[model samples]
Target chain A: GAGVSQSPSNKVTEKGKDVELRCDPISGHTALYWYRQSLGQGLEFLIYFQGNSAPDKSGLPSDRFSAERTGESVSTLTIQRTQQEDSAVYLCASSLVAGGTQETQYFGPGTRLLVL
Target chain B: AQSVAQPEDQVNVAEGNPLTVKCTYSVSGNPYLFWYVQYPNRGLQFLLKYITGDNLVKGSYGFEAEFNKSQTSFHLKKPSALVSDSALYFCAVRASRLTGGGNKLTFGTGTQLKVEL
Candidate 1:
């Protein structure tokens, strides 16, 4: 089956610019998540969406970061006024369902963002 | 808050030799432990996970891990190593859903494994 996919494999932008990264989860997946991987921060969760309930944004570092998922198909993570610290590889993942603690997450190739 | 630690920055082993990568975790509640491998310029690939019922969990590519509640550890191991196994390894932990921790995973800094032929 098709796995999770992300767009704009690489992105270079100036500081203070905004960027939008897209993710298409596997077919029939009801859970979606976004995470950031950087040399300094390692891997950190950004946000998560389960079915139609409210999205979990507790892991978001700041208000400048936000994500939206249309149903269970695709999700977009937007970083406003990006800073040099925001430079990292943005990864997306999904699972068949989110209710169980045993569900394993399948990851995407990720979008590498460079803030110059 | 849930956290994971991969104390070693790197591990080196010869092909056909046994290999082990250490991982320890701390969480307020019972943990959902997982191991993942990442190849250069690629996404992380899930290896194995320990949710419950078994202390020793086996995963893809002939990898296995033992969940130790006493030590709060989930070290990944393989009987024999392959040069192709050279890559980055990550250990992650999420607090059990019973604790209301949600599904977010806390990952370690990752350990680079170099399998020499």
Candidate 2:
């Protein structure tokens, strides 16, 4: 079975520009999540989606960060007016159920974003 | 508030020696603890988790973790380390309170494990 997949294995965008990163979760996964990993740092939670819409967007660093999942399958994370600090490895994960209690999440390869 | 702490930044050991990676967590309710390993340029892979029952939990690649409620720690261990086992290890925790939002997992800064021959 295919695990989660993220597009644009690597992206280099200029600061102040907008960048969109895509993720395709495994089939039938109802819960999806986004996280960022800076160099020598841990995974930082960003946002989460359940059934095509996000209910917990608290982890988003700022208003400039947003994400949307369509058809409960694919998700897109958009960074508006990217800052140099936004440079990191963006990771996507998904789970079979929306059980926000104790389910394990499967992660994707992640897309590395570099803001020059 | 929920959080996890990996006290050590790195752990070095010989290939045939025992290895241990320590993790401590703070949460409101009964905590669900997990261990994950990440190779360079790859996503994190689930190693093992501690839900309930026995204090000793076994996981992938001959790895295991012992849960100690009194100490508030879950330490990963392996009988013999392998050179290939060198990577970044992370400890995560999620409270079982069933909040309205979702099961948000809190991760530690991660520990780098280096196994030399």
Please, what is the TM-score per model? 0.98, 0.95
Q: Clash pairs of candidate 2?
A: none
Tens digit per residue, CA lDDT, model 2, A2-113: 9999998999999999999999999988889999999755688888888745468989999999988887789999999999999999999998866544478889999999
Best by TM-score: 1
Cα lDDT tens digits, model 1, A1-116, are 88899998999999999999999999999999999999999999999999999999988999999999999898999999999999999999999968495489999999999999
Candidate 2's C-alpha runs over 4 A off are: A52-54, A100-102, B99-101
Task: Score candidate 1 by TM-score against the native.
Answer: 0.98
Best model per DockQ: 1
Q: Please give the lDDT score at residue B46 for candidate 2.
A: 90
CA lDDT, every model vs. true structure: 0.95, 0.90
lDDT of 2 at B33: 91
Tens digit per residue, CA lDDT, model 1, B10-111: 999999999999999999888999999999999999999999988999999999999999999999999999999999999999888889988998999999
lDDT for position B41 in model 1: 96
